[model samples]
Target: MDKIISNKEKSYLAVTLSGDNDKEVIKQMASALEEEGYVKDTFADAIVKRESIYPTGLPVGEINVAIPHTDPEHVNNAAVCLGILDKPVTFNVMGMEGETTEVSLLFMLSIKHKEDQMGMLQKLISLCQDQNTLKEILAKDQDKINEVMTALVEK
Candidate 1:
């Protein structure tokens, strides 16, 4: 599975973030990936810029989530970060032009290839849409979240 979840001291896969705004949240996620060498230093800025244009927020079932990512050029290693916010932050809705939603969970992706990016996106969106899965994820700690996501990634 290529260790899709990181186990470094500053865990990247599943962690609680307390960024007060969308930009801050995205930056925090990017910083964690960068710290682990999963992404280039440019990743943080790139993702922030990308999110401004193509918002990835979705209001699925009960909870709202966001999937923020950037071009493959900014990624050094492919990995997904799951950030559970202490409080929800407002994010622009995907394809909804000017609409927005409050997102409490975020999946920040660092994909090294465009093709893989699409596949991962599809899988993540599908997983996020399941209310039960989302609830389970939110209820667990970092280690358990890693188990859940690792299982999901392997599938």
Candidate 2:
């Protein structure tokens, strides 16, 4: 798996902005993931199941996002897919605040090894703290996304 925290996207992750429903988003993410050989169809169920129990939304000021995912079993390879909605999508928040809000960012996480997963969420947490990176992403194009990935990895 390419280092998501480092912003090294090995290739294009084919994410989509479709319907407003959670299932629809999951399906879109899973299809892109499977197409990239990161996961099997089972990953859709894994993501949904994970979200059904605990929501994945993380809030940081105006940047509300979701990182819906499951364990390593569903992944054939390891990668992260980013899906940006035309309009902010709503979902239940993951933390203690537990509020529901529109999500502008979506990160589908998959890890082949559990050990590699340890610092990832924490890395994301810190990255989210960097307002400049978040601003750049919110306004970046796909090519820019790729560039951001490169910059992230070099750091």
Best by lDDT: 1
Runs in model 2 deviating more than 4 A are: 1-16, 150-155
Off by over 4 Å in 1: 1-5, 8-12, 141-144
Q: State candidate 1's TM-score.
A: 0.88
Collision pairs in model 2: 6-152, 6-153, 7-149
What is the C-alpha local distance difference test score of each model?
A: 0.81, 0.68
Candidate 1 per-residue C-alpha lDDT over 72-136 given as tens digits, one digit per residue, 9 for 90 to 100:
99998777788888788999999999999989888998888787877788888888878877877
Residue 56 in model 1: shift from native, Å? 0.3
lDDT per residue as tens, model 2, 54-152: 888877768777878789999997777777665677788886555787777677777777876656666666666766666667664556667644443
